[model samples]
Target chain A: MKNLHVNFCGVAFKNPLVLASGVLGVTAPSLSRVIELGAGGITTKSLWREPHPGHPNPTMFGTKEYFMNAVGLSDAGLVKGVQTMKELRERTKEPIIANIVAGNIQDFGAIAEAIAELSPDAIEVNISCPNVESEFGKPFACSRIDAAAVTKLVRANVGDIPIAIKLSPNVESIVDIAKAVVDAGADAITAINTVGPGMRWNIDLRTPILSNRVGGVSGPAIFPIAVKAVYDIHAALPNTPIIATGGVNSGRDALEIMMAGGTLVGVGTAIYYHGDATWKKFTDEMSQWLEKSEFETLSDIIGIFHKA
Target chain B: MGCCGGGCGKQNGEETLHHELNTEPRAFVIDRMWEEAENIRTFVFKGTLHAKPGQFCMLWIPECDEKPFSIARDYDGEIWLTICKVGPATTRLFEMKAGDYVGIRGAYGQGFSTALTPSPSPKGRGEHSKVVLIGGGYGTAPLHFTGKCHQDAGSDVTMIIGARHKNLLIWEKESKDSGFRTLVATNDGSAGIQGFTTHILEDLLKNEAIDLVQTCGPEKMMRAIVEMCIDQGVPCEVSVERYMKCGFGICGQCVVETGEKMCQTGPVVSAEKAMTFSDFGVFHRGAEGQRKNW
Candidate 1:
């Protein structure tokens, strides 16, 4: 059988399938459950130094095609969130990608420093979440300077831990932002943290569907957009490790993402559609395809689209 | 529909079912809309979303918010939502007419337990398998479907509906129309019993042989019913409401104290499990994941 194991940014994963942040990674038990379900690793829901009470009800909405959410990064504050991650670390040896976000650059560093103390396998700096733009203004990833600033500060604060700066697909130049952060000391990058702070309308109600009015769109409909973003980023920075998250629903989709330069495929919205076993389904299908193609590892296909 | 005895096939077992995952909201035409009670209305829509009794759907009102509503009735090819105008989303839903269009996704979440069905014979054990459904305020909506499911399954079903007053008491006539033996209670003594539904529940427990009790309503009322069911040794199931984002379970906002997400493990939970929750009656989390008094 072809080996599915992948080494991403110095951390080992049995497979390239990692649970994307914000799906079911809210609590320790939930994250652990995802690990048990066959995910190679899991990212914690974006945590903050202080508890943020996201928006009111109707924070999420979806159709058969896509899902929109503005959960506002509501989390259990730094102390509790870190404690949960530490507990998660104690229970399993799987890589934990601690996702952190902040209202400003300084707080970003502070939160990264605090979470780094727990010694996660990696620290994913969330500078591009579109849902929180209402509260914190346009995402840092939208501006190369701000994105690089946050990346630089987080890289400095986290010390030796690998840092992946997550980028937004809503920006004009994702590659510019990606390059800026990479140059600023980011060890890795997670491309496309949802696309468009889009809105859905309730025609009968004459109002917006999300309580937050608008939210970041994710799921199968945005898969093409995510693929392009990852492809572009990989072309720009061929050596940088990339975690492609968005609209990955099936094994074929994951394979496509890997071929587009994703070292690790992030599975989020598929769980909403296919149920929690989606990760296993993805990896299983990917393995079958690899064996059928006589490929021994994911590296054989990573960025295959770019070959002459 | 019999209960799975805590081992619902979907829970703690091999993942065997593949539900179609649709994120695009389907356009459902409102075939009919009528006021059920003082502030309650039932919207009958022509749609094709198959839903279990306790399962819910996210109703998307274009440009407005999407909210979860229990499948009150799914008769003929029509789905019904018995809504009370309690908030912005529902208020907008209430304003819509019969010809309006609305977006719908899912018939999501685990429905009520079917464990106590296939009715116990009256001669063999009359009181041992009777199903009692207690609904307070708008919480009575989903129970109508639960009662019908039990009745259709050949079990004796009784519905107790309570409201602040006679005007707010919902589904009493509908229950009666559907051939269910329904009891009504009003806080102002404007109807059958002049007190809370729990008071009527107490009298029923004293007089009848209720095998199981299922309830939904204000958390305080459900808590009382759960406590009563525990004291009487009757198995109970409850449908709870929370600030839900994704009706399928991703949002994590609809979690009860046991860390079980209401969207996944339940919008319906058993009395035994309900009692284990420290936040059951006292509080619930809001969109911010902070505790708010229920």
Candidate 2:
């Protein structure tokens, strides 16, 4: 039997396919549906200390290849979200990764500590969300000091559980940001979130189509950029587990990210557009191609395309 | 199509058939695409789409925004949308080829009345009624077939269209012979009247006895026309536009602030009801009734 199991941040998944957060994890019932459809694991929607109603209207827009969403991190708060996770644990056999975000370093640590008690498979500390006007905006990660401060706070408080820092690609150099997180004691990293706040104007109406005016851009358009970011981060921290995200639409996309040195793949907007079957598509199709290509395992593909 | 019943391909726990049942939302596919005017293209799609005019559909092109567009024509397992290449979604839509799968969902919002079901006449022909259809720019597409449907029902059809320039006037040749009277308006005096379509409509309402008035365009223009109809006591309907995410009622993304659900109830609403919109004629609404100036 071909072994499909892969280890992510020291935890085992039936395969490398995991449902990246956002709307995919908004409610427990939806999360259960994702697991039933065959995802190796699932990540909860990013949670914060307080409930945020999110931005003004028009937070999400869809295009042909992919979609752009700026739900403004509308989460149920750490306590409520942790409770949902506990309920999820009862029904799903798949590993659950909790995603946490905070306005400041203290909240990040506090939420990390709270989720740690629930015993999730791992924790993803999201330090970058470009679509909203939040405290962790450009100034926080534009310099090394802020990134280090937040990462250190989470590391100090989040007891022995594996901690991954989800980095932003909007900065001057992603390498500098990745280094800051690694220096702060992050065990792994999920590179890139949705890119730039974009806009759409209706010519007939002669006005901007989206109510938010701008939102985070994702899909095939950001695939190349995300891949490059993952490649660079993996090269910079060869030992750090990197979970690749952004514009991963299919199993072929998953394969490319792994070849670019991603240990696991994070799927978000694609799941919103295509639903849970996308996760199964990524795993089943990639497994078939991997076996047909005579590759023994996933690690063989990691960074294989980035040989210097 | 029958509902999935949330129970498909499951018999005795042995996988008997392998036809993949869609576990997610169905996307729109453009089977044929062509430019009908400068910056305007007609996308002919063949899919299992069930949509009606005034009911919006979300068109997704990978790497661009998923946009909400009105269904212009629906027939025989095919759908058509006459769109202006505005924003990233339409711009990318212009680059699509035949057979490219475009994500689609909808038949959302309230649609137009099916021509009053026609009262039976003693002569076996429906009694003639007077219907005036007004459209501005691409908003004209939905009204085209609607006017045709009216004409088919033995109603007198008059179509008044407005665009910024003369070149933007499309389908004039086709609509000219569809048993309807055509009136053209442009921002510049190059084509017909050198003013907004509402200016011409105001004159029409004052002189001619119109039984039904249907309008769709910019919110301000629609509001003006609706108000005029309200004052004159003409039965009026307007097709509205809003930023929609899921074309179905799920995502609450494309809602107008009538304090009513736009996706579930309408993109097409009575002029009397539209006047109650808090954001009416002032701004556009997003998924959650957030305003963007009209």
Candidate 3:
């Protein structure tokens, strides 16, 4: 098989398929399990300064087309988050990206400083989480200034550690926010958090499905949106690295986003559909797709669409 | 690509059968309700979940927290949930009367293997494998279902259900009504035996040539059962409980020391695998995935 390896934000990933934050990503065992099952790297669930009591279940649900969740960004807080990161570093050789989320710019810097101790391969600043608007009040990704403020704070605190600012699709201009974060000292970008705090309810119950009433829409339904977001971002900031997430369920989806200029692909909802086999299937499919072309590795095709 | 197993489109075959996560929770009206004890109530709903004996469904009390409950019985198309009025979800669930609707989905996770794993038992017939089931309190509900399935499979089955008192024991009548030999044990001596469910296991093992043992209850009791089954060289499967989110493998909240997600690799595990779980009887994660000693 052709090498599927790629370097994202200065960290070497065995392959482009990285486990997205929020899905099977809290503990060392969970993150390690995903890696053992074939993920090239792991992005932990958003780490917080203190334990967050996310909305209650049914926080998540999935269909063939989409996976919806309003887990409300529940996490075990920073102390436990760093400990798990340390455990993961000891357990696996796979690259680990510490995904941190905060309601304020100051807390963003605090978490960034704490994660620096474990020295994760990358720090994914999750300013785009869609479900926690009630607690955090409209994601920082909603405004270019707010997004950049969080990015600048995180960037200033983490020494030389690579910081990938995770952007949201529920924004007026994803590219503008992407560019602002990059300009604000971000080393990379994780494009597109869940698409919407969308609502789906059964008429029979007279209630919305999620306890939070609405949640971020993911799964294969958002695959095209992710591609477009990445395409638009890569078109403007061709030099900036992007960790493309949202609706990437197959190898073709991964390739489409890469060609649109994603440095690494984030996969989460697929675990609901394919379990651990999701990663191996993606890389294997990508290798077969690459074998039919001139590219020797996945990186050869990064932003290949822009070149044409 | 095909039936949307994440477009796992496994092998690019439309006919490929893969597991699809049931992400949608639909409403089902309670067809009936029976108060089994002061605290324990059994609600019957209309649905063809086709759940296996040990599998469970997430019970959603619209707008309240959703939780996993064992499918106590599925008769024709009616599924039953035996709930103990305890926390927020169950408390709200208890307030509902018949015809009330609640969101239900699942038949998720591995169930007790009625056919038994490893086809050839010492008797060489995995089918019709003689089995013993032990359940404590609400745990009795699922074991009763497992025992009923064994009976349906033409297997010799025995169900031993126990609680603090006769009032707390859930399925003695149901298990016995299903034609399986049923025994009851209670700590207060208000039921069959005047001791714990663990107290009866030794004598039962001495008498019965059992092929498999299945349990769900207090972790300490389940652990003891697993140890006894191991000593007897009988295969065993135990259903474990842990506070969870995502009610699936993607969250590690319900993961045991074996790194197995109870929502995925288990909720039901073999005796050998259960023994390997260091945190099995010691602790389970709280809602925040923080360790809470049991």
> Candidate 1 at residue B291, lDDT?
62
Model 1, position B98, has a per-residue lDDT of 78
Q: How close is candidate 1 to the true structure, as a TM-score?
A: 0.79
TM-score of each: 0.79, 0.56, 0.94
Q: Between 1 and 3, whose TM-score is larger?
A: 3
DockQ, all models: 0.28, 0.03, 0.55
Better of 2 and 3 by DockQ: 3
DockQ of 2: 0.03
First chain TM-score, candidate 2? 0.94
lDDT of 2 by residue, A61-85 (tens): 5665556666777665765676678
Candidate with top lDDT is 3
Q: What is the full ranking by lDDT, best candidate first?
A: 3, 1, 2
Off by over 4 Å in 2: A134-136, B1-294
- Tell me the lDDT of model 1 at B196: 89
* Residue pairs with clashing backbones, model 3: A24-B250, A62-B23
Docking class of 1: acceptable
Query: What are the Cα lDDT values of the candidates?
Result: 0.81, 0.72, 0.82
Off by over 4 Å in 3: B1-21, B116-128
Per-residue CA lDDT of model 3 for B185-214, tens digit only, reads 999899898998888878888976788889
- Residues B70-140 of candidate 2 have per-residue lDDT tens digits of 77776556678898986766777788888776555554557665445454432343367778888888888
